[model samples]
Target: MLKLGWFSTGRDQAARDLLKVVWQRIKEGFISAQISYVFLSREPGESKESDLFLKLCQELGLKIYTLSAKNFEPGLRQNNREAWRAAYHQKVYEMIKHEPVDLIVLAGYMWVVSAELCQKLPMINLHPALPGGPQGTWQEVIWQLLQEEANETGVMMHLVTPELDQGPAVTFCRFPIKGGEFDPLWQNFKEKMRQIGLEKIKEQEGEKEPLFALIRKEGVKRELPLIVYTIKAFAEKEISLINHKLFDNKGNLLLEPYDLTERIEKHLKTGEW
Candidate 1:
């Protein structure tokens, strides 16, 4: 079984829900791995959201370690963000160095990792865009997709590098934004765009825009599956991490992130992964 390390800021409901789902999957033997440690960047009482997340973790009996990035070395963090990031990650490394994990999963981890830390850890983050679709926060990515009139997008599990979101993907699944459910939504969006400019729609409607909401909904449905199945792939040795590069079980380098659309869609359709 692959030993997984989890990192998260525990900032919101999505954070807690993801942990619950992944833990449930593990218990159900859906993913052939166990989470070894969960590292949070916030401490108790950091926020009500995170506090609830902590309570759930305790209830689940998952080992958790928290270090307050909020309170750590205030002077350096104020004066020099780059140095602070490096120093902060170094301390984080020191704390978890003893407990070895085969892969570290970044879930809702807000901070950018340092180059030094990237080299030391086998880490992957779920980016809410296809392998080459867009690069930014999920909201930003969605906005860009709409602006581009893009017909397709996806989510991917990517190797975490010092450069934010530029990392090569391990696995990804794409879906079209133009057919079936999306058609009516896009038509409504075009009408709204004509009624009030795209900027106005963004300023007022934001994520609540019909097309945007559906896009996010479609993408969110896939995230938990994308992550768990990626973990499954790792646990079963279908994929391997060597010197931060991904390789198939047969020892061939993966030039691209393996596609999981068929598997994800199957689960979405028949509830079988």
Candidate 2:
């Protein structure tokens, strides 16, 4: 069995959803590997997503481990910057040391991992934009594209590096945002904004404590499938990194080098790129 370790902050619905999809895929025979353990940056008390993820892991018979940044700090600061990072990574590395983790997948991990950690294992991350798409958080990536009037955008699974979202590509799938037919996209964006705005209003009104639970719920619904597909490709040896280039099993580039917005739009209209 290919042993795997999952890393996520458990702050977003996508993170939870991604794991669920992977779990489902494994159950359905789309993936043939064992999720040896899950490592989380935050403890369950901090976020309901973390709580639920732990519960799911328990139900699935996977081991669970956590390293709280809050707890690690100060002690983490006792060492030099490099040493601190190493110490923190050691927490994660120790859990998988006894297990046979072939790959580490970052779903919604917020921190930029230390170079020491990357060098220690084969890891990959899924970004909410195309490779070299934008250098910001997922929300920022979308907002920046909107500001630039980009007509298309995509998601990519890539090798994780210290630099955010600068990883070598694994696979990318894109969709078009027709300039005139922007209603669907706009509606989606507006709905998200409205939901956030309402949540803020509620928090200010003191109806309930601030919660990130909704985001995690959405992740499980929308982002799970993509994560599963990416992992399936990896487990089946459908992905390869060669000379800093990522290739599919047949040696074709998984992500085309050029921006494919126009091509994608054309494909949407004519059914071919």
Give the Cα lDDT of each candidate.
Answer: 0.91, 0.65
Residues 161-211, candidate 1, lDDT per residue (tens digit)? Answer: 988899889999999999998999888888887899889999999989989
lDDT leader = 1
- Candidate 1 displacement at residue 6 in angstroms: 0.1
Candidate with best TM-score = 1
Clash number by candidate, in order:
0, 6
lDDT of 2 by residue, 26-75 (tens): 87777887788888888869778778777777787878888876567666
- Flag clash pairs in model 1: none
lDDT of 2 at 58: 79
Q: For model 2, how big is the CA root-mean-square deviation? A: 7.1
